[model samples]
Target: MLKNSMSVEFMAISDNERFARSVAAAFVIGLDPTMEEISEIKTAVSEAVTNAIIHGYNDTGRGRIVMEGTIYEDSVEFRISDEGVGISDIRRAREPLYTGKPEDERSGMGFTIMETFMDSVEVESEKNKGTSIIMTKTVKQVGK
Candidate 1:
Protein backbone atom coordinates (compact mmCIF):
# COMPACT_ATOMS: atom_id res chain seq x y z
CA MET A 1 0.00 0.00 0.00
CA LEU A 2 1.19 3.50 -0.70
CA LYS A 3 1.88 5.64 2.31
CA ASN A 4 -0.06 8.82 3.01
CA SER A 5 2.88 10.66 1.49
CA MET A 6 5.68 9.68 -0.89
CA SER A 7 8.73 11.82 -1.60
CA VAL A 8 11.21 11.62 -4.49
CA GLU A 9 14.22 13.83 -5.20
CA PHE A 10 15.82 14.52 -8.58
CA MET A 11 18.57 16.66 -10.03
CA ALA A 12 17.37 19.35 -12.41
CA ILE A 13 19.02 19.01 -15.80
CA SER A 14 17.43 19.87 -19.13
CA ASP A 15 17.82 16.27 -20.30
CA ASN A 16 15.98 15.02 -17.20
CA GLU A 17 12.80 16.93 -17.93
CA ARG A 18 10.85 13.81 -18.74
CA PHE A 19 12.21 12.07 -15.65
CA ALA A 20 11.04 14.87 -13.37
CA ARG A 21 7.53 14.85 -14.80
CA SER A 22 7.41 11.07 -14.60
CA VAL A 23 8.23 11.16 -10.90
CA ALA A 24 5.38 13.56 -10.25
CA ALA A 25 2.97 11.47 -12.30
CA ALA A 26 3.93 8.41 -10.32
CA PHE A 27 3.13 10.15 -7.05
CA VAL A 28 -0.31 11.23 -8.25
CA ILE A 29 -1.04 7.81 -9.71
CA GLY A 30 -1.36 6.43 -6.21
CA LEU A 31 -4.18 8.89 -5.67
CA ASP A 32 -6.00 7.36 -8.68
CA PRO A 33 -6.09 10.65 -10.52
CA THR A 34 -7.80 11.05 -13.87
CA MET A 35 -5.95 11.45 -17.16
CA GLU A 36 -6.68 15.17 -17.36
CA GLU A 37 -5.55 15.69 -13.80
CA ILE A 38 -2.34 13.84 -14.50
CA SER A 39 -1.64 16.02 -17.53
CA GLU A 40 -2.16 19.18 -15.53
CA ILE A 41 0.23 18.02 -12.84
CA LYS A 42 2.86 17.12 -15.39
CA THR A 43 2.52 20.47 -17.13
CA ALA A 44 2.89 22.28 -13.85
CA VAL A 45 5.98 20.27 -13.04
CA SER A 46 7.46 21.11 -16.41
CA GLU A 47 6.84 24.80 -15.93
CA ALA A 48 8.47 24.72 -12.51
CA VAL A 49 11.52 22.96 -13.87
CA THR A 50 11.76 25.32 -16.81
CA ASN A 51 11.67 28.30 -14.48
CA ALA A 52 14.40 26.79 -12.35
CA ILE A 53 16.63 26.24 -15.35
CA ILE A 54 15.94 29.44 -17.23
CA HIS A 55 15.21 32.00 -14.54
CA GLY A 56 16.55 30.63 -11.27
CA TYR A 57 19.85 29.57 -12.79
CA ASN A 58 19.82 32.21 -15.54
CA ASP A 59 20.57 29.41 -18.04
CA THR A 60 24.28 29.79 -17.33
CA GLY A 61 24.66 26.00 -17.42
CA ARG A 62 25.22 25.88 -13.64
CA GLY A 63 23.45 24.55 -10.54
CA ARG A 64 20.79 21.89 -10.24
CA ILE A 65 17.07 21.96 -9.64
CA VAL A 66 15.69 19.72 -6.91
CA MET A 67 12.17 18.40 -7.13
CA GLU A 68 10.08 16.63 -4.48
CA GLY A 69 6.61 15.14 -4.34
CA THR A 70 4.40 14.49 -1.32
CA ILE A 71 1.16 12.55 -1.38
CA TYR A 72 -1.69 13.25 1.00
CA GLU A 73 -5.13 11.84 1.71
CA ASP A 74 -6.78 14.53 -0.38
CA SER A 75 -3.95 16.18 -2.27
CA VAL A 76 -0.50 15.84 -3.74
CA GLU A 77 2.19 18.45 -3.19
CA PHE A 78 5.25 19.04 -5.33
CA ARG A 79 8.17 21.37 -4.71
CA ILE A 80 10.90 22.48 -7.11
CA SER A 81 14.00 24.11 -5.71
CA ASP A 82 17.25 25.49 -7.01
CA GLU A 83 20.33 27.07 -5.44
CA GLY A 84 21.30 29.91 -7.74
CA VAL A 85 20.79 33.59 -8.33
CA GLY A 86 17.42 34.07 -6.66
CA ILE A 87 14.70 36.37 -7.89
CA SER A 88 15.06 39.91 -6.58
CA ASP A 89 11.33 40.54 -6.76
CA ILE A 90 8.95 37.61 -6.83
CA ARG A 91 5.98 39.93 -7.22
CA ARG A 92 7.46 41.36 -10.40
CA ALA A 93 8.30 37.92 -11.71
CA ARG A 94 4.70 36.81 -11.29
CA GLU A 95 3.35 39.64 -13.35
CA PRO A 96 1.45 38.80 -16.54
CA LEU A 97 4.33 39.82 -18.78
CA TYR A 98 7.57 40.07 -16.87
CA THR A 99 10.24 38.10 -18.62
CA GLY A 100 13.72 38.44 -17.19
CA LYS A 101 14.89 37.64 -20.71
CA PRO A 102 12.53 39.21 -23.18
CA GLU A 103 15.06 39.30 -25.99
CA ASP A 104 15.35 35.51 -25.78
CA GLU A 105 11.73 35.02 -26.76
CA ARG A 106 10.62 34.27 -23.21
CA SER A 107 6.94 34.97 -22.70
CA GLY A 108 7.36 35.38 -18.94
CA MET A 109 4.46 32.98 -18.35
CA GLY A 110 6.17 30.39 -16.18
CA PHE A 111 4.57 31.32 -12.87
CA THR A 112 1.28 32.14 -14.48
CA ILE A 113 1.14 28.81 -16.25
CA MET A 114 2.04 26.99 -13.05
CA GLU A 115 -0.63 28.77 -11.08
CA THR A 116 -3.21 28.04 -13.73
CA PHE A 117 -2.33 24.36 -14.00
CA MET A 118 -2.05 23.62 -10.27
CA ASP A 119 -4.66 24.18 -7.61
CA SER A 120 -2.28 26.23 -5.50
CA VAL A 121 1.24 27.64 -5.85
CA GLU A 122 3.61 29.10 -3.26
CA VAL A 123 7.02 30.60 -3.90
CA GLU A 124 9.86 31.36 -1.48
CA SER A 125 13.36 32.61 -2.03
CA GLU A 126 16.26 34.69 -0.73
CA LYS A 127 19.04 36.64 -2.44
CA ASN A 128 21.60 33.84 -2.25
CA LYS A 129 19.67 31.03 -0.58
CA GLY A 130 17.92 29.92 -3.80
CA THR A 131 14.25 29.56 -4.81
CA SER A 132 11.50 27.06 -4.12
CA ILE A 133 8.07 26.66 -5.67
CA ILE A 134 5.44 24.57 -3.92
CA MET A 135 2.34 23.40 -5.74
CA THR A 136 -0.63 21.30 -4.67
CA LYS A 137 -3.64 19.73 -6.36
CA THR A 138 -6.51 17.86 -4.76
CA VAL A 139 -7.60 14.54 -6.20
CA LYS A 140 -11.19 14.09 -7.26
CA GLN A 141 -12.78 10.69 -6.85
CA VAL A 142 -14.90 9.46 -9.72
CA GLY A 143 -17.80 8.10 -7.71
CA LYS A 144 -19.10 8.40 -4.18
Candidate 2:
Protein backbone atom coordinates (compact mmCIF):
# COMPACT_ATOMS: atom_id res chain seq x y z
CA MET A 1 0.00 0.00 0.00
CA LEU A 2 1.13 3.52 -0.77
CA LYS A 3 1.12 6.17 1.89
CA ASN A 4 1.63 9.05 -0.53
CA SER A 5 2.93 9.87 -3.99
CA MET A 6 3.79 12.71 -6.36
CA SER A 7 4.55 13.09 -10.05
CA VAL A 8 6.06 16.05 -11.81
CA GLU A 9 7.12 16.76 -15.38
CA PHE A 10 9.79 19.21 -16.34
CA MET A 11 11.90 19.99 -19.37
CA ALA A 12 15.08 17.99 -19.65
CA ILE A 13 17.40 20.80 -18.73
CA SER A 14 20.38 21.00 -16.45
CA ASP A 15 18.67 23.39 -14.11
CA ASN A 16 15.76 21.06 -13.50
CA GLU A 17 18.02 18.40 -12.10
CA ARG A 18 18.26 20.28 -8.84
CA PHE A 19 14.49 20.58 -8.76
CA ALA A 20 14.11 16.84 -9.16
CA ARG A 21 16.55 16.21 -6.35
CA SER A 22 14.77 18.66 -4.11
CA VAL A 23 11.45 17.00 -4.76
CA ALA A 24 12.81 13.59 -3.86
CA ALA A 25 14.32 14.95 -0.67
CA ALA A 26 11.10 16.66 0.30
CA PHE A 27 9.06 13.54 -0.39
CA VAL A 28 11.21 11.45 1.90
CA ILE A 29 11.70 14.00 4.64
CA GLY A 30 8.64 12.80 6.51
CA LEU A 31 10.35 9.47 7.01
CA ASP A 32 12.68 11.15 9.52
CA PRO A 33 15.75 10.20 7.57
CA THR A 34 19.18 11.13 8.80
CA MET A 35 21.43 13.68 7.10
CA GLU A 36 23.31 10.91 5.40
CA GLU A 37 20.12 9.32 4.07
CA ILE A 38 18.92 12.62 2.70
CA SER A 39 22.23 13.25 1.04
CA GLU A 40 22.25 9.79 -0.48
CA ILE A 41 18.74 10.16 -1.81
CA LYS A 42 19.58 13.57 -3.29
CA THR A 43 22.69 12.24 -4.94
CA ALA A 44 20.84 9.30 -6.40
CA VAL A 45 18.12 11.51 -7.75
CA SER A 46 20.69 13.90 -9.20
CA GLU A 47 22.51 11.11 -10.96
CA ALA A 48 19.33 9.72 -12.46
CA VAL A 49 18.15 13.12 -13.62
CA THR A 50 21.55 13.95 -15.04
CA ASN A 51 21.55 10.74 -17.07
CA ALA A 52 18.13 11.52 -18.49
CA ILE A 53 19.17 14.99 -19.52
CA ILE A 54 22.63 14.27 -20.83
CA HIS A 55 22.60 10.72 -22.19
CA GLY A 56 18.92 10.18 -22.81
CA TYR A 57 18.26 13.47 -24.58
CA ASN A 58 21.82 14.19 -25.62
CA ASP A 59 21.59 17.48 -23.75
CA THR A 60 19.34 18.93 -26.43
CA GLY A 61 17.16 20.44 -23.71
CA ARG A 62 14.08 19.55 -25.76
CA GLY A 63 12.74 16.47 -24.08
CA ARG A 64 10.65 16.10 -20.98
CA ILE A 65 11.52 14.24 -17.79
CA VAL A 66 8.89 12.71 -15.59
CA MET A 67 9.76 12.28 -11.91
CA GLU A 68 7.55 10.23 -9.67
CA GLY A 69 7.93 9.60 -5.95
CA THR A 70 5.98 7.09 -3.94
CA ILE A 71 6.09 6.61 -0.19
CA TYR A 72 5.29 3.38 1.58
CA GLU A 73 5.33 2.31 5.20
CA ASP A 74 9.09 2.06 5.39
CA SER A 75 10.44 3.07 2.04
CA VAL A 76 10.25 5.56 -0.81
CA GLU A 77 10.43 4.85 -4.52
CA PHE A 78 11.51 7.33 -7.14
CA ARG A 79 11.08 6.95 -10.87
CA ILE A 80 12.86 9.26 -13.29
CA SER A 81 12.04 8.81 -16.97
CA ASP A 82 12.69 10.51 -20.28
CA GLU A 83 11.25 10.20 -23.78
CA GLY A 84 14.46 10.20 -25.76
CA VAL A 85 16.98 7.83 -27.21
CA GLY A 86 17.05 4.77 -24.99
CA ILE A 87 20.02 2.92 -23.63
CA SER A 88 21.18 0.11 -25.88
CA ASP A 89 22.91 -1.98 -23.23
CA ILE A 90 21.46 -2.09 -19.75
CA ARG A 91 24.20 -4.29 -18.35
CA ARG A 92 27.04 -2.32 -19.85
CA ALA A 93 25.46 0.91 -18.78
CA ARG A 94 25.27 -0.19 -15.20
CA GLU A 95 28.88 -1.19 -15.02
CA PRO A 96 31.03 1.06 -12.88
CA LEU A 97 33.10 3.67 -14.77
CA TYR A 98 31.56 2.54 -18.10
CA THR A 99 30.50 5.72 -19.78
CA GLY A 100 28.59 5.78 -23.03
CA LYS A 101 29.86 9.30 -23.67
CA PRO A 102 33.52 9.33 -22.94
CA GLU A 103 33.93 12.52 -24.94
CA ASP A 104 31.84 14.37 -22.35
CA GLU A 105 34.06 13.21 -19.50
CA ARG A 106 31.12 11.49 -17.83
CA SER A 107 32.19 9.15 -15.06
CA GLY A 108 29.45 6.63 -15.97
CA MET A 109 28.72 6.31 -12.27
CA GLY A 110 25.08 7.32 -12.46
CA PHE A 111 23.62 3.86 -12.07
CA THR A 112 26.36 2.91 -9.71
CA ILE A 113 25.66 5.83 -7.42
CA MET A 114 21.94 5.16 -7.53
CA GLU A 115 22.43 1.51 -6.72
CA THR A 116 24.78 2.34 -3.91
CA PHE A 117 22.38 4.78 -2.30
CA MET A 118 19.07 3.05 -2.84
CA ASP A 119 18.03 -0.39 -1.70
CA SER A 120 17.14 -1.35 -5.27
CA VAL A 121 17.64 0.20 -8.66
CA GLU A 122 15.86 -0.89 -11.83
CA VAL A 123 16.38 0.38 -15.33
CA GLU A 124 13.94 -0.06 -18.20
CA SER A 125 14.56 1.16 -21.72
CA GLU A 126 14.08 0.46 -25.41
CA LYS A 127 15.77 1.65 -28.57
CA ASN A 128 14.53 5.10 -29.58
CA LYS A 129 11.84 4.80 -26.92
CA GLY A 130 13.36 6.11 -23.71
CA THR A 131 14.72 5.07 -20.33
CA SER A 132 13.27 4.86 -16.87
CA ILE A 133 15.26 4.58 -13.65
CA ILE A 134 13.31 3.29 -10.69
CA MET A 135 15.07 3.39 -7.33
CA THR A 136 13.85 2.63 -3.82
CA LYS A 137 15.30 3.45 -0.40
CA THR A 138 14.02 2.11 2.87
CA VAL A 139 13.99 4.54 5.74
CA LYS A 140 16.07 3.36 8.69
CA GLN A 141 13.61 4.79 11.24
CA VAL A 142 16.47 5.75 13.49
CA GLY A 143 15.50 6.41 17.11
CA LYS A 144 11.93 5.39 16.46
Candidate 3:
Protein backbone atom coordinates (compact mmCIF):
# COMPACT_ATOMS: atom_id res chain seq x y z
CA MET A 1 0.00 0.00 0.00
CA LEU A 2 1.54 3.24 -1.10
CA LYS A 3 0.82 6.17 1.21
CA ASN A 4 1.88 9.80 1.01
CA SER A 5 0.56 13.23 1.79
CA MET A 6 1.23 16.92 1.28
CA SER A 7 -0.16 20.26 2.43
CA VAL A 8 0.28 23.80 1.17
CA GLU A 9 -1.10 27.23 1.95
CA PHE A 10 -1.25 30.24 -0.30
CA MET A 11 -3.05 33.49 -0.73
CA ALA A 12 -6.51 33.09 -2.25
CA ILE A 13 -6.13 34.73 -5.60
CA SER A 14 -7.13 33.96 -9.17
CA ASP A 15 -3.53 33.45 -10.23
CA ASN A 16 -3.11 30.70 -7.67
CA GLU A 17 -5.79 28.58 -9.25
CA ARG A 18 -3.35 27.22 -11.82
CA PHE A 19 -0.82 26.67 -9.09
CA ALA A 20 -3.37 24.68 -7.13
CA ARG A 21 -4.14 22.54 -10.16
CA SER A 22 -0.48 21.83 -10.77
CA VAL A 23 0.06 20.89 -7.15
CA ALA A 24 -2.84 18.47 -7.24
CA ALA A 25 -1.61 16.88 -10.43
CA ALA A 26 1.89 16.49 -9.03
CA PHE A 27 0.56 14.88 -5.87
CA VAL A 28 -1.25 12.20 -7.85
CA ILE A 29 1.37 11.56 -10.49
CA GLY A 30 3.00 8.89 -8.39
CA LEU A 31 -0.22 6.89 -8.48
CA ASP A 32 0.35 6.38 -12.24
CA PRO A 33 -2.91 8.08 -13.06
CA THR A 34 -4.11 8.07 -16.64
CA MET A 35 -4.30 11.22 -18.72
CA GLU A 36 -8.03 11.39 -18.17
CA GLU A 37 -7.51 11.03 -14.46
CA ILE A 38 -4.97 13.81 -14.51
CA SER A 39 -7.30 16.09 -16.40
CA GLU A 40 -10.18 15.35 -14.08
CA ILE A 41 -8.10 16.01 -11.01
CA LYS A 42 -6.77 19.26 -12.40
CA THR A 43 -10.23 20.44 -13.38
CA ALA A 44 -11.66 19.59 -9.98
CA VAL A 45 -8.81 21.35 -8.23
CA SER A 46 -9.30 24.40 -10.39
CA GLU A 47 -12.96 24.55 -9.46
CA ALA A 48 -12.35 24.13 -5.74
CA VAL A 49 -9.60 26.71 -5.65
CA THR A 50 -11.58 29.14 -7.74
CA ASN A 51 -14.52 28.79 -5.41
CA ALA A 52 -12.29 29.52 -2.45
CA ILE A 53 -10.94 32.62 -4.13
CA ILE A 54 -14.14 33.93 -5.66
CA HIS A 55 -16.99 32.84 -3.46
CA GLY A 56 -15.30 32.24 -0.15
CA TYR A 57 -13.05 35.26 -0.17
CA ASN A 58 -15.11 37.34 -2.56
CA ASP A 59 -12.03 37.88 -4.77
CA THR A 60 -10.51 40.05 -2.08
CA GLY A 61 -7.21 38.17 -2.45
CA ARG A 62 -6.61 38.58 1.26
CA GLY A 63 -7.37 35.17 2.71
CA ARG A 64 -5.45 31.97 3.02
CA ILE A 65 -6.35 28.86 1.07
CA VAL A 66 -5.01 25.62 2.38
CA MET A 67 -4.86 22.64 0.03
CA GLU A 68 -3.99 19.19 1.25
CA GLY A 69 -3.72 15.81 -0.43
CA THR A 70 -3.33 12.25 0.75
CA ILE A 71 -2.61 9.12 -1.19
CA TYR A 72 -3.83 5.69 -0.05
CA GLU A 73 -3.06 2.75 -2.30
CA ASP A 74 -4.72 3.62 -5.60
CA SER A 75 -6.90 6.37 -4.31
CA VAL A 76 -6.29 10.04 -3.61
CA GLU A 77 -8.14 12.54 -1.46
CA PHE A 78 -7.91 16.31 -1.50
CA ARG A 79 -9.14 18.90 0.93
CA ILE A 80 -9.30 22.58 -0.02
CA SER A 81 -10.12 25.06 2.68
CA ASP A 82 -10.39 28.81 3.07
CA GLU A 83 -10.90 31.09 6.03
CA GLY A 84 -13.35 33.41 4.38
CA VAL A 85 -17.04 34.14 4.37
CA GLY A 86 -18.70 30.76 4.37
CA ILE A 87 -21.70 29.48 2.58
CA SER A 88 -24.99 30.43 4.19
CA ASP A 89 -27.04 27.71 2.50
CA ILE A 90 -25.13 24.68 1.42
CA ARG A 91 -28.14 22.90 0.04
CA ARG A 92 -29.09 25.70 -2.30
CA ALA A 93 -25.48 26.27 -3.14
CA ARG A 94 -25.16 22.73 -4.43
CA GLU A 95 -28.21 23.02 -6.60
CA PRO A 96 -27.42 23.25 -10.30
CA LEU A 97 -27.34 26.67 -11.90
CA TYR A 98 -27.54 28.44 -8.56
CA THR A 99 -25.17 31.35 -8.20
CA GLY A 100 -24.79 33.39 -5.05
CA LYS A 101 -23.31 36.21 -7.10
CA PRO A 102 -25.52 36.39 -10.12
CA GLU A 103 -24.19 39.80 -10.96
CA ASP A 104 -20.83 38.26 -11.70
CA GLU A 105 -22.43 35.97 -14.29
CA ARG A 106 -21.28 33.02 -12.31
CA SER A 107 -22.52 29.74 -13.71
CA GLY A 108 -22.83 28.28 -10.21
CA MET A 109 -21.42 24.97 -11.43
CA GLY A 110 -18.38 24.78 -9.23
CA PHE A 111 -19.83 22.05 -7.07
CA THR A 112 -21.33 20.39 -10.08
CA ILE A 113 -17.98 20.21 -11.87
CA MET A 114 -16.26 18.87 -8.80
CA GLU A 115 -18.96 16.22 -8.38
CA THR A 116 -18.68 15.27 -12.01
CA PHE A 117 -14.90 14.87 -12.01
CA MET A 118 -14.36 13.26 -8.64
CA ASP A 119 -15.86 10.10 -7.23
CA SER A 120 -17.11 11.91 -4.15
CA VAL A 121 -17.20 15.49 -2.89
CA GLU A 122 -18.06 16.63 0.61
CA VAL A 123 -18.61 20.26 1.55
CA GLU A 124 -18.22 21.57 5.09
CA SER A 125 -19.00 25.18 5.84
CA GLU A 126 -20.17 27.62 8.46
CA LYS A 127 -22.12 30.81 7.96
CA ASN A 128 -19.28 33.11 8.99
CA LYS A 129 -16.34 30.84 9.67
CA GLY A 130 -15.19 29.33 6.36
CA THR A 131 -15.63 26.49 3.85
CA SER A 132 -13.85 23.26 3.10
CA ILE A 133 -14.31 20.94 0.15
CA ILE A 134 -13.24 17.36 0.55
CA MET A 135 -12.95 15.26 -2.57
CA THR A 136 -11.74 11.77 -3.40
CA LYS A 137 -10.91 9.81 -6.52
CA THR A 138 -9.84 6.25 -7.16
CA VAL A 139 -7.23 5.70 -9.83
CA LYS A 140 -8.49 2.96 -12.07
CA GLN A 141 -6.08 0.29 -13.16
CA VAL A 142 -6.16 0.42 -16.91
CA GLY A 143 -4.41 -2.89 -17.30
CA LYS A 144 -3.32 -5.64 -14.95
**Cα lDDT, all candidates:** 0.83, 0.93, 0.93
Expressed as tens digits, the lDDT of each residue in 107-133 for candidate 2 is 888888999999999999999999999
Question: Model 1 residue 6 lDDT?
Answer: 52
Model 1 error, position 119 (Å): 1.3
Worst 10 residues of 2 by lDDT: 135-144
Residue 48 in candidate 1 has what lDDT?
A: 86
Clashing pairs in 3: none
Whichever of 1 and 3 has more TM-score, that candidate is 3
Q: Tens-digit lDDT track for model 3 on 3-80?
A: 999999999989999999999999998888999999999999999999999999999999999999999988999999
Q: What lDDT is reached at residue 45 by model 2?
A: 96
